[model samples]
Target: MPTLAHQQIHPHPHNKSAFAKHVILLLSTMMAGVLQASSATDQHYPIDVQSCDRIVTFDHAPKATVSNDVNLTEMMLALKLQDSMVGFTGVSGWKTLDPTLRNGIGELPELSPKYPSKEVLLGADADFYFAGWNYGMRVGGGVTPDTLDPLGIKVYELTESCIHIMDKPKVSMNDLYNDLLNLGRIFNVESRANTLVTGYKKELADFQAHLTPLPSPTKVFVYDSGEEQPFTSGRYGMPTALIEAAGGKNITDDVKKSWTQIGWESVIDRAPDVIIIVNYGDVTAQQKINFLRSNPAFSDIPAVKNNQFTVLEYVEATPGPRNIEAIKHLAKAFRAAL
Candidate 1:
């Protein structure tokens, strides 16, 4: 019941319906004794609960449009519910949206890039707010779910960003699938969700069958997110799968955890065949490449010598429905080098 905005504003959206329901039932049974001792009105607190108590629930799901980013919005479209959206932000130039959805996405006002003033966000009269994560809305900065809560607006965080309650124990293609399933249920589109999941699995299976086993997989390094210290994904993260699917060995596979600090000496010792840098909002791929080429330590590596460097959009690297496409693109890039 703590009202700290950031505690719930996790990087990923999470789903805790099953666990929450069980706990609620157990707690309500125990609290029955305490409630019986108090006034009858006190007993009503446990009876009127909605599944997710952190945010308020509406009597009817409202027309919503997501403003934070594309992955969540695209998944909704895949569910055939793009029409449910009324507005979005930071997507005027999006090329991947279906033509129909593009028009819809375009019509919606942009509330992001920078968080909209409290008045701007509320003025949309949105019933539900969908966000990729919480960074866009933090306390003492811009309006957050808490800001909208008092006004009776609801917010649903994308399940992929929910680090605490992800349906998959870890972030992976499996986690994205789980989120798609949950979104289908949320929007009453189970059959469509099932169809999309089936199609994606079949496509991936077919693609995997065609890949010849790696005869001599060379060590490859993914240098994502940082220039000075270098932030890279370790063995357990999405980058591991990306490296393997592309038929290359990940040099960072021995390290554990999602993101970690790595020393320049490790890169020198491993001597990766290829290096990939992820590009996002402010930094371009060219900037990362320029940084590495000028660095004293990496300039001598074989990867740098051969210019076996590549860059990918940050969204494609994230664990979501688009990951298979990312893997295929990486595989193509790696295979071309051979």
Candidate 2:
């Protein structure tokens, strides 16, 4: 065979025109993509969204926002909204900040180590507060919507926590998506938010598909904190949805509460095969595990007898980007029979 440099080669006239047309088509497609990307950031201004019972109107995108808690902050960071934020609150109070979260904040300060007081938020001059009831606010707490609105700070309540102040159905992953979608529209980053939500849904579905089916859905109990009475997640808590997604049942689902106390008798009656420990605060996870191990009351419980327990960090068990990975861990633990 002759080398190209030593041989004469000629393209047909139609072929040359076809190649030119292909180049023009490719360039036009590229230009269209560029225009679409730019348009994604365009805002109409004065958008209204129904968040829980409140009809929140955004005259303009908030310039200084503060997200409370580690998991909630992770959601904001996932959307790349860090530059628009003033800082965060509620991370250092109960749990230490891990390196991944610490670096995501970069130079941003932790405005308050615990639940920030209204004055702390005011001092930061935050124009928006990304928080939930009990996550960062109480039913009538000092840092609630009633207090923040007059201070010119817009509040978006986490959907899962809505059950605390209002009547709502059981928690689902859609609650997580709704939060991101609303935040996207509020920030004029709707395209980014939609893309992230879509990716998450697809990723979660894919994760569930690969999971080997157990003999049945594994029974799961979420042990948050308790010594005398157990404080745990119930029907409306994010863990209910997470446990269901991992092909397990949350034993506390019948309680009809979020993070609340339940009778120790109910826990013993349910007898979960697996116990998920939410690790945080002054009390160590091992200590909590040992408590269950040594207690004569729990001696007959299935999980206690088998010592089948998994630990999730405070952030992993809450609503955020980490939940999917947490589900994978849960599925493996739930289906360990294989």
Candidate 3:
């Protein structure tokens, strides 16, 4: 015969197991709370947690003359420092900008081809090179930081478009804001930069607050960069954020890479409500429209059929302070099309 304690326990073994399970659940809940608090703390003190190597400090402002590029050109315009631009290349979209704003900036010189030739760039005698993209450094074609560094010019790549290995951290709104703030600091305009940052944050917050709830989120197709093998802004890219904020679905949201190419058939099957066509260099809105219309595969798309197309000028669409303008434009266009 078993003892009284054993007999009592054996009769209700299930109760003991149930109690053990409750204890485990309570412990897990406590752990989860701790983790949540830790995450919150990290968010609160992000700067302190960031790696030291990721931080780049500038002691004094650089007198930067931007090469012909999209984002940097727009940033200069937003800052009203157009006088500082001495030399540039790629002049196709000069006419597309608001005529009022572009009044005094007449007949821009094609200082260089797609990438400025070494002779043309050197002739400009710039203090610093501010390039929008990394392709400026092609061998034998244009001047690069490595090529210009010897000639007493420092280069600062727009951190937003810094995709190369040697470039800065991943692009974000914070990165763009910080770059502007840093530029302000360098140029002895810290106060003005802070003011700009304040305005930008407020505008973004306002947009976030007024976002309309969708009955069914409209599918959107973003045609970025290339046409031969379509490049799209995937999970981490700016296009993904742009689509999400405007209350439309990014067709390529499922793609895990920063940018990816997809099949034309896939896009046709999904039948996106709106189409975004980005133009850089010599590519014009009319050219993109013509291509879409001429192509047998894409002529039947709902966006094309309905004429629901929004075109973004190079500088406005690039990730920078001008991004707010792009987002607003997209929202307006999406609403109008719907």
Candidate 4:
């Protein structure tokens, strides 16, 4: 017949110990859950990503994003971030979108046919910009990081293209891997990015393992564009990395430039065993090949003489998802030429 309040404060003797233990266990479980949630939250947000020489920090995944160029845009798509993108720029100005790329982009408007101004991005309400030096943002251009940052837009520079604005190590396929992983982190898609990169590494290794050791590496040239002098991929270009991985040597490896116009004389002097023509822009790949085949200047080049010209799309030549397939094509072509 004890009052209800008295029973609540002090249960029967036998039940008191049991009630205390129950209360302790309940509180302990609640505390552990709170601690676990805090750990997860700390690990994911406020991520810091290295963009060229700069470190950009993010508090949350960007809701509105824009990318430039087919290669960089393709990287975003590869991470399945299309839903976050408002639009893209830097295609159709110089390069045509192939069916695969065209479809990957779906209905996203081409914000600009070429490099867009800061106003264009701000108009789209973009929170993130994925581009690299000269790929979309030129040095001192209207759309540079400095110009856009004040507008609340963050930028992520392409690793391969960073050589344009900052001193970087020699180019490698790792450049491609880094971009994918870092983008994955920025967009909160780290798990997908890690898995894709792992598969790429294994695929590249498996292909290289099957390559027969050659007496000497095949001398290769990457022809991007330029009728006046021939814009070729040099030591720091992604094609150079691809060439090396395919068991071939880039004849321009000594040029000390990434992608630049070199004298046809330099190309003639080195005498490439194979020429990888980048397919893009106003001219067709065949026209580029025809130019080489018909020209007396290149008649004596080994690749020209043997008709060893291999065609790779602009996407394949640059750092992108197609790099592995491009390398495979090059390796087969190199051996066939040999």
The residue-by-residue lDDT of candidate 2 on 195-283, one tens digit each, is 99999999999988887888788888899998999889999998989899999999988888988998899989988999999999999
Task: Please give the clash total of every predicted structure, in order.
Answer: 5, 0, 1, 0
Model 4, range 59-178, lDDT digits (tens) per residue? 988999999999898898889999999999999999877789889989998999999898899899999999988789888778887888889999999998888888898899999999
Please identify model 3 stretches exceeding 4 Å from their true place: 1-59, 93-101, 104-110, 138-142, 166-171, 224-228, 235-237, 254-262, 279-287, 293-296, 299-301
| Top candidate when judged by lDDT against the true structure | 4
**Lowest-lDDT window of 10 residues in candidate 3?**
45-54
Model 4 pairs whose backbones collide: none
In model 1, what lDDT does residue 201 have?
A: 85
**Global lDDT of each candidate:** 0.64, 0.90, 0.63, 0.91
lDDT of 1 by residue, 139-231 (tens): 344566667777766676554445422223444566567667756555555588899999988888888789766667757888875765778
Among residues 3 or more apart in sequence or in different chains, the pairs in candidate 2 whose N, CA or C atoms overlap within 3 Å are: none
- Taking all chains together, each candidate's TM-score versus the true structure is 0.68, 0.87, 0.68, 0.87
Name the candidate, 1 or 4, with the larger lDDT value.
4
- Residue 114 displacement in candidate 3 (angstroms): 3.2
lDDT of 2: 0.90
